[model samples]
Target chain A: MATKTKPNGKSEKNQPQSTRLWLMFPPKLITRPIVWELGQKFPLVTNVRQASVTDEIGLVSLELSGSRGDIKAAIKWMEKLGIKVEPVEINVIES
Target chain B: MDKQTGFMKALKCRECGREYPLAATHVCEFDFGPLEVAYDYDRIKASMTRSAIQSRSKNMWRYRELLPVAGEPTVGCEVGFTPLIKADRLAKRLGIRELWIKNDAVNYPTLSFKDRVVSVALSRAKELGFTTVACASTGNLANSVAANAASAGLKAYVFIPSDLELGKVLNSLVYGANVVGIKGHYDEVNRLCAEIAGKYNWAFVNVNMRPYYAEGSKSMGFEIIEQLGWKIPQHTIVPMASGSLLTKIHKSYQEMTKLGLVSDAEYSVHGAQPAGCSPISVAQKAGLDFFKPVKPNTIAKSLAIGTPADGFYALKVMKETGGAADDVTDDEIRDGIKLLAECEGIFTETAGGVTVGVAKKLIASGKIPANDSAVLCITGNGLKTLDALVGHVGHTREIRPSLREFEALIEAETKSPTAA
Candidate 1:
């Protein structure tokens, strides 16, 4: 008899997933120059909807929709060039 | 059914637990509680982990399992993963054992935590096919929404109180948003935004797109846990405005625990506010089930919400978490601002001052145990509201070129001991 493997909480390291791209910026990128850099990247980027600054750590959260390949490439390229890029998480409270 | 990219599920109401189709509707029909975006938790829990998150990128989106937007991002592409500094010097001054500061004042674009929420809201807005986005903000939110909207090529409309600080107005206008100076206070502007949400299909991020908007705040809490070796703090101190961020942070901690990314631990959540406008704090102080709105006459403009929509729920959370609320004076707020910068090198805005001031007060009152670790949320940068300290802060000494003259002045100043 074969025992079933329980899926522990672990990030799927080997899976190549295709999903829309979204990025959150560090506080330092909020100045005029970084905005220009972002424009150059996701040109299909319709708008930078929100910009919020906290006391010490600055974060510029951006929302853009593009192909999985282009978005993933853009994220990788930005990270390579020292730009902070991460996947946007979706949260739901079962209230 | 190509699997929607930037979104996960439907919108859920905060009060009645009613669900709505994914769109820009932020309020519910029954009792009018705010609606927020829901997600597929099983999918998120199955995929996200500490190593996966670390390997991805530095921004908040790295925890894509926790955010609402589906597919690839198109704007506000650079945000989140802000510094969670260990406040060693501040701990020494306050006589606390371990203290951390979530420094969001330096957040990119407009410099406040609002960017996190707005980024998600606006991103979802575009995905829902919205060309125009709007909001009712006091200062920081206005600056962020205007700038982000401009960059994303969306027509932006910003409605703010007429008497808002000139710096805030200028920051929003610089982004080329259609800035509307309303005659009433922020609450009036917010009410107007709600009205417009009922009449228009255009996305009002905070009003209609709030479900997605609030998800952004979770990044702050997520970063705190991740930076702390994937462990949640013993206590968290946050300033309450609309009370959304505080509630969201709690949700983040719970989610992490549920996903087994972090262990279950007892945590105390504390809230701070200016004495001039502190409904939540006052309710917490009086041990009441509800909050009584005030006229809001505080220097901490960011925390000056008289009637916070989430006030009651925030009170409930504080009670549930064994947390407490504290208030500080305007002078204390100013002193708190200077103290954090001087001790911790974190230049915080007035809202941050309230949090810091209350943190100090809580420490002195033996409320926050000296042994337990604590994290204080500093919400905005001080530079945006310098007018609050025009005549209060900085040194004004007349110096002469000659050494002899300077020595004489120094001696005189030292002897008198009354020089500002």
Candidate 2:
């Protein structure tokens, strides 16, 4: 459950920055309450950024960010839950 | 760039008039009323002329001298210059003298008028040295924020109600933005974004960055007047959601008159909303001074904010302008969408349908005069909300590919006319 800290040593001036990721799912995957199930994997997650389901898109994007390794593994585990993950590129990262 | 001549001294609260340093703050601490970027009118009046503006590019940034942002624009360089079409056929059908369609549906990249606002927000965010940009949106806004942010090389986090349409989801995700679907309604999603905005140093476009963001919508009003050869419409019908666009249009018209760019004339502003979730229209109908929030339930999901942030101001503007607010049924919304597309070849989403539908209702009810020119603001493209119209249209004729099949179809079509 320990988070992986990057050895890049950019700066500790603020908190270790984490980029939020968006994951979408099909309706059947969401009907089984799989998004919350994915949330269970990231025990150290500072927050479940967002989650939702609609008629037009079925299950919409859910954003989460916190510990690096915890977020990566939680996302990988979400694939098992039938969720599709897309890495949202950030142009500028700030604490 | 000489900031003193372009931007006003500072942004001031609409209610208290308390001034704040020109950062991105929107709300006032004393009354919670939203603040607006006030400009030095005399300076603009002296500099801005119809010929001066017309000589520039067709984009919204053409009014850069009047916009709030100080430096170079970082987004939506090609966003504005949308077509302002004359709806002659639609005018005859609706019994109006002159009607125009502000076709913002084809706005670049994301295809919603929100691109106008996001373009300003992202430009200011970069100028402030912020690394991340984010927002709480219904659907079109998320698409715009994600796409514009991606194009500007900024990380974007877009929050939305989980029940958004598929096209919008794909639009945002394709831009590689961190799109979040909150489990609650749009208001809840907006609240969560506000909380996150306080905790993080990110630029939340409609939140902390709203003062500059809302200013972007003024271009629509500016474009309409300029396109009409520097004459203001006597009546304008705008869709009501956040109410920012409606109020901003009103502001632009007034500024034009003040600057002597247009002749002084009395303008009436009307607002439209779906009956399913019409807090502002309901308040206006009841002749109430304040809007009472209601849980939204409508196909026009884009305008389904039960407690709109600017509902009060919207009501006040309608009353002051001697304008009326009206709502249309869901069936009418679909009809409005079809009516616009069929008449003017403009495909708008449900919000646009609400505007057109209510415009019809208002004209029939004698709220809008037949002699006045009316412009309907179509904010988003129909493709974003195609599911709302699925199965509501189309013909089903089980006929073989032959002259006999066609004859039979014509005979059957005459025998049983489908209800439109």
- Tens-digit per-residue lDDT, B214-303, candidate 2: 889988898899887788887899998867788989998888888888899888889999999898898899897666556678999888
Q: Provide the clashing-pair count of each candidate structure.
A: 74, 9
Question: CA shift at B192, candidate 2, in angstroms?
Answer: 2.1
Residue B336 Cα positional deviation in candidate 1, in Å, after optimal superposition: 0.6
Question: What would the per-residue lDDT of candidate 1 be over residues B1-420, giving only the tens digit for each residue?
Answer: 125743377788776788988876665554345687777777777688778888987887888778887666666778777889999999988889999999998787768888888888888888889999887777788788888899899999887777766777788899899988778634334444554554678787766677788788998999999999999999999999867788899989988999889999999889998999898998898897666556689898888776566777789999999999999999999999999999988888899999999999998888898877899998888887787887778677777688998888889978887874
Residue B56 in candidate 1, Cα distance off native in Å: 1.5
Error of 1 at B141 (Å): 0.4
Error in Å for residue B61 of model 2: 1.2
Lowest lDDT block of 10, candidate 1 chain B: B185-194
What DockQ does each candidate score versus the true complex, computed on alpha carbons?
0.01, 0.03
- Per-candidate TM vs. native? 0.79, 0.79
Weakest 10 consecutive residues of candidate 1 chain A by summed lDDT = A86-95
lDDT of 2 by residue, A31-58 (tens): 6665566566565443443344553223
Instruction: Give candidate 1's whole-model lDDT.
Output: 0.75
